[model samples]
Target: MAEPREIPEGPAHERVTVVLITWQRREEALVAVRRLLELPERPRVIVLDNASTDGTAQALREAHPRDSAGGRRLDVVVLPENQGAVARNTGVASATTPYVAFCDDDTWWDPGSLERAADLFDADERIAVLTARILVEPGGVEDGIVTELRESPVQGAPGLPGPALGSFLAGASVVRRSAFLQVGGFSRRLWLGGEEELLAADLAAAGWELCYVEDLQIHHQASVLRESTRRRRNGIRNTLWFTWLRRPLPAATRRTRDLLRSLPPDRTSALGVLDAVAGLPWLVRERKVLPPHAEARFAALEESQRTSKSRNYSR
Candidate 1:
C-alpha cells in the first residue's frame, strides 16, 4: 500500500474558501473550524448554521468574538428553519473565492489538502471536483468507501489523474465554486443523505470531470449522534431518484431490479420504496436522460456497484 502523502505547505492558489455546514453539534463544529483556522495558508472560512437549536449560534459568536471588532472574518448565516442539503447551497452562494472546499462538522482537511486541491483544479480546467482520500480519526483506518472510489469503473480516455468518478463524498472533496454553482448545488428533494450523485451527473453532462487524488487526505471522526435508519432510507430513495433522472430506459430498469433483489425484505426497504414512489410524479416531470456517452459512463458503474461491499443498504 502507498504511504499517506504529506500535505503541501506553500500557497497553491491566490485564495481558497472553506464552507462548513453545522447543526446542533456545536462542540464538534467548533473543533473543526478551530483546526481549519490553525492551518498555515489562512484560507477564508464560512459557517452555515442550519437552525441549530443546541446553542450553536451562541458558541460561534463567542469563539469568533471579533467578527465585528477587526478579528478573524467568519461569515455566519442562521437559517430560520432546517434546510438539510439545501443549507450548502445557501452557504456556497456566500463564497467569493475561486475554490470552495466542503467539510462536514465532524471532518477537517489535512494541513494543506485545500491548497493542493486548488492546484489540481488549476492544472486542469475540465476538473470540477478533486476528491480527497478520507482517513478515519484515532484508529487511522482508511474509510471503507474509499476502496470503491479508488477502483471506480467509470471509463476515461488515457492519462487521467485518477479513476473517473460518477460521484464523490461531498465532505471530502474540494470543488470549483463557479462550476458547482453553474450545475446547481445539491438537490432539495434528496435533502441530506448521499446527495452528491445528482449534482455529479449534472456536472459530468456539462463537460466537467471528477477525479480522486490519493495524495490528498481529509480526517473524519464519525459523529456519535446520527439517525442511521432514516439515513439509509434516504440514501436508497435518492439512489432511485438519480437513476431515473439520468439513466437510459434499459439501464434504469436493470438498476431498479438490482436494488430490489439486493435489498432485504424488511421495514427499511419498504420505507425506501414508499419514499421513492411518493416522488414519482416529480421524477417523471424532471427526468432528463443522459446523452449516449454519459449513459455509457454511468452503465460502467453497475458492475462495480454489484461487487462493492461499501454499498451495503444499511447505516
Candidate 2:
C-alpha cells in the first residue's frame, strides 16, 4: 500500500471517527469505503448501510472482511430497514471517538481535514459542529453551498474558527458526539431530506456553536443514481416541518406562506405540501418554539436563504 498522507496537527484517531451512511448505491459505497480507510488520519470507520436492496452491506462486508482493515479499524452496521437520517444515529452511538466526521456514500473528507477539525474542537468546548467547505469532484471547484457557508451571517461566539452558520450539510460536517446525542441525532419524522436544519437549530438552542472551516474540506462527487423528484419532494416537506416545529408563530406562518407561494405549480410541489400538511397532528404535538438566542441566529440567515440559488426546491 502507498504511504498514508501526513497527519497535520491533532491526534486524529483519538478524536474523530468517520461515520458513513449509505442506501443502495453498492458500487459507490465500495469506492467510498476504500477512500475513507486510506485517510492519513487512519481514523476508524463505521458504515451504516440503510437496508439497501442492492446488496450494499454484504458487498462491503465481503470487500473488507475481518483480519484486514475491516477487523482492525472498520465496522459495517446493516440496518434492518431504511431509518433515513436516523440510521446515522446508530453509527454515532457505536463510535468511541469524541467527534464523528459524517460521510455520505458519495462524499469523503480530505486527508488532514479530520485532524484540523479535532484541533478546532479541542480549542473550543462550546463548538458542537464544524461544517467544511465542499469541492465537487473531477474539476475540484467549490460547491454552491460553499459560498453560503463562507459568508454565513449568523453571529458565533468570539472564538469560532470561521463564519457562524445557521445550518450545516451533514455529509460534509464533523459533529461532537455529546451535543448530537443530547438533541437527538436527527429527526425521525424528517427522515433523510434536509434533516440537518432541525438538529442544527436544536444544538444552537442548547448553547452549542456551529461554524464553517475553509481548510477542513470534504469532496463530493454527487451520485448519478438518485430520485431527484423524490428528494425534492422530501426536502420541501422537511423544510416546512422544521419551520413550523421550531420557528415562532409569526415567523413560522410567514415562512410557510412564502414557501407555498414560491413553490412551482406542479404535482411534485402539491405532493410535498400535502406531505407537510398530512402530518399536522404529530407536528402540532411536537412543536416547540426556539429560544430567543437560537431563533435570532436563524432570523439572521433569512435574507440569504430567500435569495440563495442553492436553496431551490424545484428540480
Candidate 3:
C-alpha cells in the first residue's frame, strides 16, 4: 500500500469529475443526480442521456439547472441516440479534470472516495484505474463482486494501494484520464454490458495497472427498470468477443466452450451465443493476442472466473 497524503483541506471538484450515463429511466436517474449533487466532494458531474424517449435529458436539466452561486452544477449531454456504455466516452471527453469517476445512474460515490482516489492516482502513475468497494444499498452489505475483486488471483505491481485486478467495474471505479484516452475509452463494438474487460486488457497491455482499493467505497441500488435480458445477452456475447479477441487459440476455444456449457438453457443464452457468432468476421479481423505479461495476468484469473457467482450469466 502507498503512504496516505494529508495536505488536503477542500472539496475534490478540481481533481475529479463524476460521469453518469443513463438511458430511459428518467425518474431513477433524476434521483441519482440529486443525491450526487448533494455529495460533500462537490465534484463537477456530467450526465449523458442516451436519447431516451422518456425525457431523461429534460428532467435532469430541470432538476439541476444551476448551483447556489449559479455556476453549472451539472452538465447534461443528450446523445443523438442510445450509445450504451459508449455514452461515458463523451462525458469523459468533456471533463477537464485529470480523473473521471464512472458512476452509474443507480450508483454514486461515497463523500470522500473520489478525493482519496485522486490521491491514489497522484501517488502512483502506473495505476490506471482504482475500483472501489461497493456496498449494495438498503442494508449496506458488501456486493458479491467485492469478494472476487478482493481475492483476485492476478498479481499486481508492489506498492499499489490494493490488490491488483485483471479488470474493473466501470460504474464503481475512478480512472486516470490519460490512460483511459490512450486506450480509446470504452469500446463502441462492446457498447454496454461487461464492456470493462477489453478496456482493462488494453490498459494492462499499455503498461497501466488497475487495482481494487478496499477502503474507497461506493453505493449501489440495483435498478429494477434495467433491461435484464439484453444486459445478460450482451454480457455473454462480449465475454466471448473479448476472449477471442485477446486470448490465444486454445484459451479462447476453452473459454467459449466453458461459458457455453455453464449458461442456462434459455432464449437469452441462445441469443448471446448467436450474437457472438454474428460478429465472427469482426472478431477475426481484430484479433490481436496480448503480449506475454498482460496475457499472463488474464490467464491467472480463469480459475476464479469459472467459479465466481458474480460472473455468472443469470438474472
Per-residue lDDT tens digits for candidate 1, residues 1-315, read: 112233233464345788899888999988998998887668778888999999987887788777556766567789898887778888789887768888889999898787777777666667788898989997878999898889888876466678888888899988887788888889999988878989988888877788888988999998997778888898889999999988989999999889888888889888998999999999999999987766767888898777678875844
Per-residue lDDT over 99-132 for candidate 3, one digit per residue giving the tens place of the 0 to 100 score: 8999999997888898899888887878899999
Q: Pairing residues by index, what is the TM-score of model 1?
A: 0.93
Error of 2 at 163 (Å): 0.4
Q: Is candidate 1 or candidate 3 better by lDDT?
A: 3
- For candidate 2, list the clashing residue pairs, or say none: none
Estimate candidate 2's RMSD in Å. Answer: 5.3
TM-score of each: 0.93, 0.95, 0.95
lDDT of 2 by residue, 1-315 (tens): 112223334479988999999998999999998999999899999999888999988888888778845356778888999987898899999998888999999999999999999988877778889999899997899999899889889998887899998999899999988789888899888988999999999999988999999999999999998878988899999999999899999888778877787789999999999999999998899999999999999889877877888986967
TM-score of 3: 0.95
* Alpha-carbon runs more than 4 Å astray in model 3: 1-11, 67-70
lDDT of 2 at 27: 97
lDDT measured at residue 153 in model 3 versus the true structure, 0 to 100: 89
Better of 1 and 2 by TM-score: 2
User: Would you list the C-alpha lDDT of every candidate in the order shown?
Assistant: 0.83, 0.89, 0.89
